[model samples]
Target: MRILLVLVAAAGLFGCAALPGDGPAAINITTQDVEDSAQSGDYTVVTIDPGNIDAIRSYRPMAFANQFRGVGRGGSPTLLGVGDTLTVSIWEASPDGLFSSGDSGSSQIPSVVDEHGYIFVPYAGRVRAAGLSIEGLRQSVQKKLIGKAVEPQVLISLRDKLSSTAVVVGDVAKPGVYPLPLRDTRLLDLVAQAGGAREATYETVVTLKRGNRAGTTRLEDLIDYPENNVLISPNDNILLSHRPRTFSAFGAVKANQLVPFRTKSVTMAEALATVGGLRDERADANGVFLFRYEDAELVRRLKPELAEKLAGAETVPLVYKLGLRDPKGFFMSQHFEMRDKDILYVSNHPTAELGKFLQIIAPLISNYSTVQRITD
Candidate 1:
């Protein structure tokens, strides 16, 4: 009597929004919203088939600049610059010269490269030293003292350097400015100088901002590709960001959690297994969906029509459907790679909702039946 009325009311509520649901049903998500929409929606669903798998891949495995060639050979970064302290030593055969005094035939004079890129000596009046090497300035001083000194030999030593320095910030053990002595100093050398990155090579993203033209590459790419380990330039900023790639699993999956990518990349099949696969009792095999915000250029190649609808957009919202009911779907999943921030959601089976509803009312029905018997 009471149990029957409650059962009827619960059933009526189940058909409405009152029934417990982990997420929207497969059909409602797939079509119902668009069908009853007052305006067109921002997203579109596409089936994952053999024809679209290749077009779906926009993941940048290596973002390094392909044409990036490091500094030239023979170690050419010996040029002088402003704010450098130099020790100019001049040696003469006789003790009586411009840079010689007492019984010594040599003298060491300290000079700082001025703002005008010049250094002054007693004999060599205002010679350019900023753009020239130490040897170049030494020769210029020697030439100036040719007639003044007896067999003069001039030598210049750099004391304090302030021009050829680079900054290393972000996920390094040491984040500060470092001097780059040689022009051919590679990326690996710079990273080592900073006590290496705080994170693993694969998990870290290394960015190079050089003047107006900036580029980026994975730390793994620098180690693997010898050419990608570009030379460090002065005023360059190298940032090692500890950005680990990850994807999320929700709905009918065994674990609704964020899954980290251990390696450089992981296939869709591997991602599914990592999250414990789909829930057998509740999962709808036909409704395995992947949600992503794809680059507009990739969308143009796959669905030109959709791309046309969303003109001048940088990224487009996409929902990719994969049906595991077919045996072919298993092979397709193996080749479909998972991108960072991608979402894997398996819809619940329709009968699973009925199961939940029945479980909720079972205790009420049993208690009511027991009361009816006692009253009788």
Candidate 2:
């Protein structure tokens, strides 16, 4: 009997020591600690209420598609530039005109625009072609040949484009400098010409760099929103990149693992569901937490009152708590947006440790009693 009691007591003590709270890295945190942490100036603790939900939703980054709404569609004629090749056809009304060739009274001249932005014609010296539209250049040549030729008529068209080219590189199968078409070329047109993005649409990010400004949008957004497929300009640098967004699930969950979102946006409830939901037997319904670092400027815009209270906190490491004990908490989870690199943790109930201790000793006590009765 003494041996049975000793064995039972040892098992109980071992189980208690193996509990999560007794470890150096404790997984269990009380509500008091979460609330006091903010007052202690250790970290910001945001209890997700209706007001907090509104603030967080308001501060989330706007859809990449929204930034491209103002981008204009392709319709404008392409301007000529230096290093472009032009094919000019000039016709003379008279048989003895300067440009006459047998009964045709016309000549086709292929000229490349020089560094001086001018192209030379047979009788019309050097005429400016760069920065002028095809029709504009034709009129300029006709004006020059008015007295030199008999009722001169001219037609100008782009033979080749060398100076007006855009660099389409990064995450593309055929990345290179692509020439801008005579008609305005839009974003998707250039991408398609370059063999499209190598990565999946949802995982791809497209960045457009024009002069000193740069803008980024998801490739899926460009495909879904026609307005986002804006016109591409000369010398624009286009980059396609793959950056997958993911969140980590830890503690008391069905399966603790890094979960990747298949869509551009995902809600907290959906993220929890993806990790197989919480482990019902061990999970503390009131101790679910989400950890992330938020932008200070965004916080200021969304939660000005809280922003003022945490003026000195620069890194803005925030912990958002949700109590699933209430039925409405599940509804609130639907509204909470999950961001990249976020940590979702569901702690175990305090009584669960004692339950575990009991489980470990119950079988041992039963076995010990059977042995003692047999010996008696």
Candidate 3:
């Protein structure tokens, strides 16, 4: 009886509250930590609801598809520019004319557009070739050589394009420099010309660098949304890297590690099921938490009260809680979209904390009971 009294007193030491278990409990998130307030990281808790599921889905990570929209892919006419190699053919009606050579009445001349955007011919000197199409430049040369040669007929053909080329690198089957097409060439078309991505579209990330600005998004995003594919431009550097989306699973789950997203997206319900679900013996069903960092602009729209509080902050840390004890929570989880690098944690049950305490002191209680038996 004395030993039993001592055990009861020891259990009473943890009165009003259970012992600290694996990670913070759902109740601890909002309350202040009286002992060391600084230790508790600043974060906001958001409850998942049907009214805001669409808004949550709208704001995803690494989606710079907006940058691609309205940029590049203009159907501009391809003209002869500086560093362009051209083949000029000149024909003369008389054999004694300047362009006539032996029995042949025509002579072929290889020329290059100079830095000043002008090309020099045998009879026509310093003709403006830049910004002029093959047919347009041909007419200009013929007009210039009208009096110099005997009925000179000038023909201009683009031998090589030295400018307006883009570089394709990383994860692509053919990584090299390619000239931009005359017609409208979008991102997908440029990628196709490079022999496509070596990795799966869903598993690859496309990074486009244009001048000083650059944007990154999943290759799958460009494939799924045509508008986001945008247009390809000269001097644009494209890179395709393998970046499989994944999230970390921690706390009272069956397996504690990083879990990969198999499809284009994985919801909270799917994420939980991926790791064999929460542990029935140890997990607190009411304390399922998902930790993420969202843009401040999005947070202001979702939670209007936070507009003034988060000044100049780009991203705000948000902890989303879902209580499975409520029958509607299961459905809410289905609507809750998970982003890359999200953390899915299940808090330990209060009863489970007690069980752990009991396990630790079980040998001590057994030793005391054996002593009592020996004394008796």
Candidate 4:
């Protein structure tokens, strides 16, 4: 009997608090409340009220920015390899020191970087040359030719690179790591290397990771601002995630529900198409709604809050909603961006909230009575 009652209460908790009539109900969430909770340093659900879009747009997290750019900075130091090229020049050495000295137009041998990331010298043996920079490799050769020739002067450089690579995964055309053959590999170059993201993916949502941490960057931003189109670094990993497909449709809609669609990037018009749309036959189109959760707390945090609220409840719903179709009704679908684990709900037509409340309570009471009777 006790177990039965507990189960009943649990179900009631999830399906309760419904408003009056058939259509969705009006939802009210205050920006002040969210801010106050945030200021208190509580990592709880920071319910973003309808008017908070501007705040979200302007909000910047420096931690996230630093995480992405860090990838290009921590690669392992190594030598150049095969299929590599370099342009070498000796400062004050004689004809033999510079391959073709005095700009003679090189009548003898064709000078070019080798495929093995190495360069050949007249008497210096085959010195490894691929990975190192121009000055870096130069010092290396200078060190190697100590007693070989008369003050054997040496200078080595990377004239051409042929061993660069990067990995692409998640939502791209061909999800795998690829090799790049140039020192100057751009963001778009990698995208091309991977064959681009899948058709179901949002091209704008892409992330890059160096090691453990990752950062998000927009495709448009990289195109419009070349600086964001970062240069590729060796051993760097790029992951592309697909946006979630769930949305909330509320207000004058016939049935308010958390609906799941096949793809992400859903428009207000498309969301409406699901669940039979605004019960124009019975709903108020102007009052259609979608309640989204912005900055919802993780599931772990919700459990403690529910325990405190219910005194000893086993579980609780730690979710908050913001209605979109209220003031700037039409803007609901356009400006709203859906994220993972988001909640979408259509509001009840005025009278539905009460009916929902009664329906929820009735189930609980009946469940309790049935349990008691069975026990007796």
Q: Which candidate is the best by TM-score?
A: 3
Residue range 237-356, candidate 1, lDDT tens digits: 789999888999988989999999988779888998999999998899888988897766666667665555667665667778888999889888988888778998889998787677
Better of 3 and 4 by lDDT: 3
Q: Which regions of candidate 4 deviate over 4 angstroms? A: 1-66, 69-122, 128-132, 135-164, 169-186, 198-207, 216-231, 241-244, 248-252, 255-270, 273-276, 280-328, 331-341, 353-376
Full-model lDDT, candidate 4: 0.53
Candidate 1 overall lDDT versus native: 0.78
By descending lDDT, how would the candidates be arranged? 3, 2, 1, 4
Candidate 4 residue 232 C-alpha distance from true site, Å: 3.3
Give per-residue CA lDDT, model 2, range 245-347, as digits (tens).
8899997888889999887789999999999987887788888888898765555555466655667554566777888989879989999988778999888
Name the TM-score of candidate 1.
0.71
Ten-residue region with minimum lDDT total, candidate 2 = 22-31
lDDT of 3 by residue, 29-89 (tens): 7463422322243776777767676788775543466555555653334987787888999
Clashes of each: 0, 0, 0, 44
lDDT at position 179, candidate 4: 60
Among all candidates shown, the one with the greatest lDDT: 3
Query: What overall lDDT goes with each candidate model?
Result: 0.78, 0.78, 0.80, 0.53
Between candidates 2 and 4, the one scoring higher on TM-score is 2
lDDT score for residue 257 of model 2: 91
lDDT of 3: 0.80
Show model 1 residue runs off by greater than 4 Å: 1-10, 13-17, 32-41, 44-46, 55-79, 84-116, 120-126, 132-139, 149-161, 180-189, 207-218, 221-233, 262-264, 306-312
